[model samples]
Target: MKSESKSQHVGKVTHHELKQTLGTWQLWGIAVGLVISGEYFGWSYGWASAGTLGFVITAVFIAAMYTTFIFSFTELTTSIPHAGGPFAYARHAFGPTGGYLAGAATLVEFVFAPPAIALAIGAYLHVQFPGLEPKHAAMGAYLVFMALNIVGVQIAAAFELCVTLLAIFELLVFMGVVSPGFQWSNFTKGGWSGADTFSMGSFHGMFAAIPFAIWFFLAIEGVAMAAEEAKNPKRSIPIAYVAGILTLVVLAIGVMVFAGAAGDWTKLSNINDPLPQAMKFIVGEHSGWMHMLVWLGLFGLVASFHGIILGYSRQIFALARAGYLPEWLSKVHPRFKTPHRAIIAGGVVGIAAIYSDELIQFGGQTLTANIVTMSVFGAIVMYIISMLSLFKLRRSDPNMERPFRAPLFPFFPAFALVAAVICLATMVYFNFLVAIVFAIFLALGYVYFLLTRHQRETAPTDALLEE
Candidate 1:
């Protein structure tokens, strides 16, 4: 409940004793799983601002950014592989204050993402079985996945690998199933709603759509946080990172193109359960296979819901362990060898976020838009800082060993940083209210850290451990 200055050497006193249980493919599962839901739901939001073709253009542009950024990012993760992800890198490159900001921003990103995903999972469930309520389903998912993560990293990674593969397979099935009815005509008719097709309005819409387009690849960098748990962090991390981004890129293009081609792309856009809605075309609305596909698609959301819980917990543990957050948040469950306290803390936040709109009555606007915009805000912040760390470390720590060097050095990372900042600006321009709320949260965290920069780490941490 108190604040403390970050440890002089991050992780020097309270070493992260996480069990190294992940392999390359398993790590890839975490990366892809953390992002699989993006393909299922949020990307459709892009269609609101841009037409089918516009969204495609947005996706292709963002894909190129991620492709460049990930290559440069992997070099950092491989060189300084740690559970802190951006937190650790920022600490090494930008000192403790910078480290705190990076960790806070990452925490914001990972922590906020799951609630949106949990809502999606609930929507998927409700879409399939009308008897089940979305809120109840979302709450239940948080409980199940948190327990799975606490069970064991190896077990969770294996489970994530299975579900992620299932999600990917489902995308392929969707493409095959929908290819028959594909009409390029459907992609354009009434597709560019709410915006002029060839005017300044379309350009504005394209800019507005950028965040949702980035959703397809967002949080894929989360795999780097699992570096501390990978069997061979050096060799395995690069393979997993590279492969994961490539997989998502292919799936993003495939799902968007075919789904829009199958029917009025607008129907799928701006909805929580776009995948299942689109699949209604192949099988009639009430058909048994339609229900089956709807149920199967839940795996995509589950993969993300589960994987991101894993990610945020690690980030939480790393932050608390380094004294940037509550000391107890770093306490590991003795038997489970997992950061149970951190997992529970994040779960509590996520569930609360699931009901934020109802709790506060944010007028008539659904909380998902606010939540997604806020999460993307956090992501853009981390992306900028992480790219900065790559350049800083190259100049500051010349001896750092990078198993995988980014092919085009400064150009790729520099480009990613500039593009990400512009994306941040666009999201803020469109979603100023969400950005204001997010800034308030960040300011509150800073105040806590400033006030409690002198707490005794051991006494406080031990007290919580005993609880």
Candidate 2:
């Protein structure tokens, strides 16, 4: 048909054209970089719902979910190795519709995650400098990081590696400084709420803490989105993915346990920087330890903030290149060899998301909480579709080359899928407002794609597989 021919006008670029500059360390940088901020804040929100013990219970469950999911997901990322990530896998297995939904979920995940970190960055600075306001500092962070992303990716990735290293160092230092102040009594004083034993409130609180637990490792999946630019994706991705998750699990457990022990657990809950606040217990507020954490801790935020910018940019570029979004968004900068347009687009949306709720309040929910839950909602959907894609591909394309196979096969992904579904359901029930907002965002995106679907001119990035 003429329509099909017209749509075919959209073109695809060869892999050699995209520029493969990232190596194992850079890949590791991006993987952990996109998630290290989770160690800084947001996890403490769990304490507001479920005290220390209940929060730990929820954290343990979610950690298991991430550990299993990452193993199975590595299989898809290695075999397909496309920038679209879940979108590519779903499209290869299902079709355009499946790819569109997966990309949208990815968009939701990467797009909203950075702004929450931006706010935290602002909060950290505000604590140090009384004159600077949190909102202004947050918007300023967006400006600075967005420009750095536009200048170059190698620069960005190198910076990501440095900050990631710095963040790891900061955590190590935090543990050492706080260990002397850590007492078993602080952890158990209000360990269980409502009853000395277990209460229904704490039970409900544990599930309510799911989103916060998810925060500790939220954007780790974003490592796959940079596949097009990785020098040797097959070798680098699996190592980065596995190493990143294991590091986060240890840091999450350490920071939570030590932080609770350092101070009144309840006081540390829902704050911008629990570690810095907890440090005040030993080193006075005016001490060098407090000053060091406040300054270096910015690296943790920058690592995630800068790295997730890389993620959402790639997601935008991938979506645009595949016809899920506008074509211009996919074009790489000639000078920088990075998706500058996509980076700018993501920054614009993120800044708007930062201020949007301010103009219209919703149930006293902070913008940070709403965005985090909504991102998790998208993550949950992506997990389900991606796992389904894994199974579907196994059945549909039995001969495909997979460099790294999941250890337990179907069992790992199946357990991850179940856990993802439960987390999704819990978010919808407890955080209905954000869930509805996320649904509305998805509907609007789908409707736009529906209107433009027939006119889009794009071919599958891996069309040779079928040919």
Best by TM-score: 2
Each candidate's lDDT (Cα)?
A: 0.82, 0.85
Question: Which sections of candidate 2 miss by over 4 Å?
Answer: 1-17, 458-467
TM-score for all predictions?
0.92, 0.95
Residue 375's lDDT in candidate 2: 85
Pairs of colliding residues, candidate 2: none
Model 1 clashes, total count = 2
State, as a TM-score between 0 and 1, how close model 1 is to the true structure.
0.92
- Cα lDDT of model 1 by residue, 1-467, tens digit: 31233223233345447888789999999989999899988888889878887777788889988999999899988887788899888877876567778888999999989988888778767866899999889999999999999988899999999999999998998888788888988877655544435566677778889988988988998997788889998899989988999999999999988888888777787677776678787666887766767778888989998999999999998888766777788778888788888899999999998877765335344777667777888999999999998898889888777788988878999989998888888877887777777788889988886766564243223111111
lDDT of 2 by residue, 177-244 (tens): 99999998888777765234677778898998899999999989999988888999989999999998
> What 10-residue stretch in candidate 2 is worst by lDDT?
1-10
